[model samples]
Target: MACKVQKRVSLRRRLHILRFLTNSNYNKLKVALENVKREYENLIATRRDYIRLLDNNVNDNKDVKIVKISEGTFMVKVTCEKGGGKLVAILEAFEEICVNVEEAKVSCENEFSMEAIIVSEDQSLDVTYVTEVILKAIEK
Candidate 1:
């Protein structure tokens, strides 16, 4: 009976040590994964900042334009156009301007007018700036 009790106590201690080791290893892995994620996010932010700086320096006229023709009616545009051909070209332009656009109702005319209803989440200057950019892009 004494021997059996001693064996059981030994087994319990071994199991406790094993569990502690496993939990410690798991916690380390979790920390490593979190660090990796933070590093990845930092890299992405750096790349984005670099691209923003490049675009600003290279393209002098690239802007978000807005115009208010009347009360409760406005037009907006951005200068981030890409892709191939004219339709694609216009679409790319629209996309470039839309990076900062939160919500908008858009209508495009291949030869005429491109009208849109824009709702911006945050604004530094005014909503009319968005409209001006859109008009300029469409005219181009």
Candidate 2:
């Protein structure tokens, strides 16, 4: 009878230890998740600030922005107050410049906006010249 009581006490002690460890682990996981959430929010805020800075530096008069992403890849963005056949015209201009459009996203609701990823075979593709060509196309 004494041995049975001792076994029951030992079992209860072990269960108590297990419950404590489980709670400790749960608390640790909760803290880690909170930290990850904080980092994600900080990242989002930094991105928003970066985008705002870019917007502030942009020339309102010009509706085109072309950035050289890599050696032969360019990211093109165009925004205009008018919407019509601008998409077709811009694609035609890209064809003339001999740049392949790998991906393009266009929004023509109320206004016109286009973002394109262009890959050029010509390593010497001039950004200034491409900007000028796209500007001309937008004007037309």
Candidate 3:
């Protein structure tokens, strides 16, 4: 009958519309995902550059390690060769900027290590300044 044909066509049309909407939503989600990935990649690249600059600036005469123990706190630990007095002075200067050695121990004659915690009181201290301090300390 004609009525039966009309009902079938209407159902078919509804199903087609539903499929189109689903495809559109899927495309939108895909685009959003790509945008997020790109932004994340950019952030990672920037962080890498900043870290590279810091590492290069730091004195490499010995083995100096800086690790972030928390979100806003960092620990600078250094183990240097004999006569590392210059590096010590540089670290001491950090005290003026509120960087303090929470624990420092110097052994008999083979090793010396200090755990200095750097926490910015104003959250405005740039890592560049910290890098400069490290470089200056190692300057010959």
With a 3 Å backbone cut-off (N, CA, C), the pairs that clash in candidate 3 are: none
Q: How many collisions per candidate?
A: 24, 0, 0
For residues 10-72, write the lDDT of model 3, one tens digit per residue. 999999999999999999999999999999999999999999987765435355567666655
Residues 39-91, candidate 1, lDDT per residue (tens digit)?
99999999999999978774454445557534434455444333223244445
TM-score of each: 0.41, 0.55, 0.43
The digit string of per-residue lDDT tens for model 2 on 33-80 reads: 999999999999999999988776543445788899999899999887
Better of 1 and 3 by TM-score: 3
Candidate 1 global CA lDDT score: 0.56
| Residue 125 alpha-carbon offset, candidate 1, angstroms | 38
Distance from true location, Cα of 88 in model 3, Å? 14
Task: Estimate every model's Cα lDDT from 0 to 1.
Answer: 0.56, 0.88, 0.67
Higher-lDDT candidate of 1 and 3: 3
